[model samples]
Target: MTITLVQGLLIALLAMITGLDCWLQAFFIFRPIIVCTLTGLILGDLRLGVIAGGLTELAFAGLTPAGGTQPPNTVLCGIMTVVIAATNNTSPATAIGLSLPFAMLMQYILLFYYSSFSLFMSKFDKYAAEGNAQKFKRLNFVPLIIVTLSFGIFAFLSAYAAQAPMHALVNSMPQWLTHGFELAGGILPAVGFAMLLKVMLKPRYFPYLLLGFVIASMISFSNVLPVALIGGVFAAIEYFRTREVSDLKEQIKDIDNGDDQDGI
Candidate 1:
């Protein structure tokens, strides 16, 4: 489907806001899952958008930015996943794989933008030396505005120009290749789960994880809301249980200290 210019602009604006939240705002509205769902809603395919977004979230869950190093571009990956899936009738896995390269490219683009923006540091120094608060604040915002605008332009291009090429590529794929991609996509989420477990698993949480798995096994895959609710309840229980334990320990310490004072 061809995106109208106005729709394209709206999408670009959404992308800019989403990208800005990723680092600048620290709000999670720009996460891969959320971005994918939003893109899907915009393109008239919310189901595909949600599935792709959720799978992509799992795939990237183990990654995070660390000092000078940035993770792969989740915003780009999420947008491309929804776009490809909506336009090309591709499996989530195929769309995910297809979007990986572009996500990497976005990472490089961000790096370059940051590096180039650093050239303005001398201007910041001048403003600080002059005690010009207005200029300093404006200079501080320059990188944010530029980066946000760049993300919007990239989103617009993807929404507008990517359809034809992606359609052509999908149409040319052999049946076996298509089936293979579907199979790969089906397993991709497991990889994401494994990676997440690797990072988040601790001896203390092992029992909780096992309990979740056991409860999840009894439910059908189509029903997730129940599972989520049960998990939330268990999490709350654990939180309160831990808090009580800590409070008891603190009281016991207070009593021991009081006894020592009485002896003195």
Candidate 2:
């Protein structure tokens, strides 16, 4: 709970790094689990980080930002969740419960930040259009640093500030409301995921997604065979299958063309 300023800053730095371009093959911050754990180590609470990351991972297990679909704010949640759980000695349920709104807020901060910076993106666009490649490349770092530093500052402030409010809120709240917030935290993000599904999920593929949940539950592999992993695997298969179908159709067209030539 009582982290030194040096320790606190390191966590913020790590959070910024994870939140930054960490968009791996498909997602930003694939390193939250690792980042959060390292942060806990610095904060003198490794176990808290591990447990928080594990639970938070599941809450966000289904929410991957694939293209235009916005996911829950992993940006802040990664470090913030760890801080709350570690500082307050909260359980995964409590910590995970706390992470959702923060994550949602982060999503919009990013969206608005993106939109605002997009004004500059037009500048980049102009340079790109003009074939001013050097200027275009140099201009790119501006937004990158801005986003990274924003998260870094946010994490630093939240680590210290969140302690007071969260402690006060928990102490002052009636048991019922506190419990309700916990439950709502778990449930609220389904709306986000639904938004994501509405955008990216293929109707025909819903069955497979359901099957994934069923299979994981049946085998008691809830965390392991998560919806995101299942969805990603399915997405990959669909991609290849769609390509294969296109190739076959093209081959058929070519054969038909040859037949027409022979007839002539």
Candidate 3:
């Protein structure tokens, strides 16, 4: 399934927008799930796109940067995953492993982008010192444009040129290795979940966490949306219950204060 020039350009445009959205708009189009779905749409395979996006999204969910470090590039990873799956007619799960290298590569690209853009800091300082708001704004916008084009060009070329070689490589791999990749892809998301739990679990939230696990285990995977809705309902209940309890405690404290004043 070869993508035409037009389709390739569209994919590039999506990449640019998603990359820019990460910092500029902060609208989260760079997220794996959304970007993958958009890529799938461009490739004329929405179902596969969603599946790839969702799996990758889970794998990437807990990978947000901390301490000034960037995480793997989900925008590039997601697009490549869907592209690989669509091109090779492989399972979306398998595409996860296939796209991993590209994700890491994009991560390095992002680091380089930051380092290169950092050179403009002196120019920005100069503009600021001179009170040249126009040059300052131009300096800022220049990096953004370059970053967008970098993302666009990388995604476009990867999607356009990598498909044939990638499919060939997968086909030539040993059966064991192929299976290993599939297995790795399937379990990758669990790592993200474990990371999330490590960060978020607390003694007070244990019950809710266990309940969520129980519900997930009992439900069919296809029914996750409904299960998520049920969880949302319970979460709302818990929130309101906690709020009311806090309010009641505050009222009791107020009453006690009133009694003290009367006694005085």
Candidate 4:
């Protein structure tokens, strides 16, 4: 399919938006529902966008950025999956099957960005020490936007260019190998998930993640209402308990001041 420059650029811009969505999604920066819905709208297929976003949402539902680790790149997974499926050619089932591998490939890319972010943080703090606030702030957005936009633009063009290569790669691939990759792709997330779980888990909190998975799987509601509410209640309780502890310290300080005043 020959795409005119304007058409190509539009496709790419839309892809760029999806890439931004991915970066944002790494932190759940924006809700997956909104981001995926927007991408689907740009693609002129809201149904696929929402559907892709919803499933992608569930896939990473248990993950978050707590002490630094974030979920795998579900934003890219949803965008690429939806775009490929929305193509007049591919069926939704095929698109989802394809998305499984693409999402895993994206996980490596996530690690790369994460390492790069660590480096950028060092540079950013150096700028802050020098009192170059503007430079430090610019450093924050520029690299993020660059990496993100590139991911989208490259994926967009590559989807077109790689069709032939991907076909050849798949054809030359042994039946067993392809099956193995597909099988490994599913198995691999549990590894990243386990790593994430290792860091983020508290015995009390871990069960909620499991509950979210269970609820999402069993219910067809638009969102994980029941289980998410459970998480929310727990989080709120945790918050007030922390605040209560903090309040005690302040009260102790006030009492000390009063006692000192009386002595004076």
Candidate 5:
């Protein structure tokens, strides 16, 4: 499907908004789940967007910026996954692998931005020393604007300007290579989940994890709502149980303090 100019503009607008949000860490609308859904909406393929979003979100679940380290760019991954899938008439899985280069490109762009912006630090200090609050505030927005504009430009180029070439390239790929991409895409989500488990899985939580695995494997449903509901129930139980334990500890401490006062 050909991407109309209006659609391209809308995608660019969305990219700008999410890019700013990512820089500000204000709203997490930059996440793949939100970004992909919005991209799909703009592309007039809500179902495709939703499916791609789910897969992409999982693949990125364990990835986050830490200190100076940046993971693969989530916003580009989300947008291009949907855009490629829609434009090239390909599966979301295949599109995901195809979108990796774009995501990596954005990652490098952001890293360059970060390094380039550091050169302004001395100027920032100078403005602060001179008590120029206005200048300081304005200077802060320079990087933000540059980042936002870059996102819009790149998204427009990839989604619209280069659509024909990308479509041709996708169509020219061998069946085996396309299948390889699909297999890789399918495996990435599990790898992401394993990464998360490595950090978060505790002995006490193992039973719940095992239970979830068993339920998911043994049962078949039209959708995942039932599994989500069950997980919610387990989460609630854990929350209340932890609260009760905390309350008991507080009560015991209070009683001990009272007994010590009486003895004194």
Candidate 6:
């Protein structure tokens, strides 16, 4: 579980890239699924990374930031989960619970950054008023640099400098405590999915949800690909049906307008 300096640097570089993407809300490679997989690749354990990524992704699926509110940092959750699991030879589930504190630390750091960066708003406004686009653009990079550097430093520390302590801590945990974490980790995805459904589920989509549930329960497969494929087909059908209904409505509206014009 010795993380060499080169590996640590590579991970830090990955963190910086993903951190920038997260800030920009650009390509969402910052998601746990992608982050974890890449981290696993760097650590020479792609399978572990894929497994952990899938679990971690589900756990984080509903924890997206809303407006000014920040959820636990997804990037740290993903990286630390794989790192801890691989380093300690622990289960991914256990690593997930252990990684929570790191995630929260990043969450708080981001909140602090958000507040501190607000102080620059006046400067931005001043630049805008004076029509100094060059200064404004240069100033914009200040926050981005700070955010990415923080990510790199913290990621390097967590994955390399702190690896020994993290490994020791996982080893010292009581069996019951470890089991508890595993249980919680398994349940978290369901809870996250429920939270998502609470926000997104509508009457029109209820049937599809029910259908998916039934199909999933009735078919015991090695993987979810078959179920996903079936769901995709249904989704396509729904899309086309909805489009047809919309077209029909538009046509009726046009016909009514024409009749009214003729009568006039």
Q: 1 or 6: which has the higher TM-score?
A: 6
lDDT for position 51 in model 2? 68
Candidate lDDT scores, in order, read 0.80, 0.70, 0.84, 0.62, 0.89, 0.89
Score candidate 3 by TM-score against the native: 0.80
Provide the global lDDT of candidate 6 against the true structure.
0.89
Query: What stretches of model 2 exceed 4 Å from their correct place?
Result: 22-31, 125-133, 185-196, 200-203, 221-264
lDDT of 5 by residue, 81-163 (tens): 99999998889988999998999899999999988898999999999999999999999889989999999999899888988
* Residues 1-264 of candidate 2: C-alpha lDDT, one tens digit per residue: 566688778877876777775532234444456656766787877887776666566567557666566676675677777777776665655666676667777788787876797689679879989999899998988888887887788778777656788767656767776578567657755765676677758988689768876877677553554666876888899999999999999889889788656644
Q: Which scores better on lDDT, 2 or 6?
A: 6
Q: What's model 4's lDDT at 12?
A: 63
Tens digits of per-residue lDDT for model 3, 1-264? 878788889999999999899756578889999999999999998998898888889788677764355777888889999998888877777888888898888899888877788788899899999999988887788888888898899898888877778879877888788788889987887766666677778898888778877888987686568667877998899999999999999889889788756644
Candidate 6, 143-165: lDDT as tens digits: 99999999999999999899888
The candidates, ranked best first by TM-score, are 6, 5, 3, 2, 1, 4
Runs in model 1 lying further than 4 Å from the true structure: 2-10, 25-27, 32-34, 41-71, 91-93, 111-131, 228-237, 258-264
Reference-based lDDT, residue 140, model 4: 81
Candidate 4: regions farther than 4 A off: 1-8, 21-35, 63-71, 88-94, 104-107, 113-145, 164-196, 204-223, 230-264
Q: Which stretches of candidate 3 lie over 4 Å from their true place?
A: 65-69, 115-118, 225-230, 244-264
* Candidate 5 minimal-lDDT segment of 10 residues: 61-70
lDDT of 1 by residue, 51-76 (tens): 98888887776556642357678898
TM-score of each: 0.74, 0.76, 0.80, 0.59, 0.81, 0.85
Two-way lDDT contest, 2 vs 3, winner = 3
Q: Pairs clashing in candidate 2?
A: 73-103
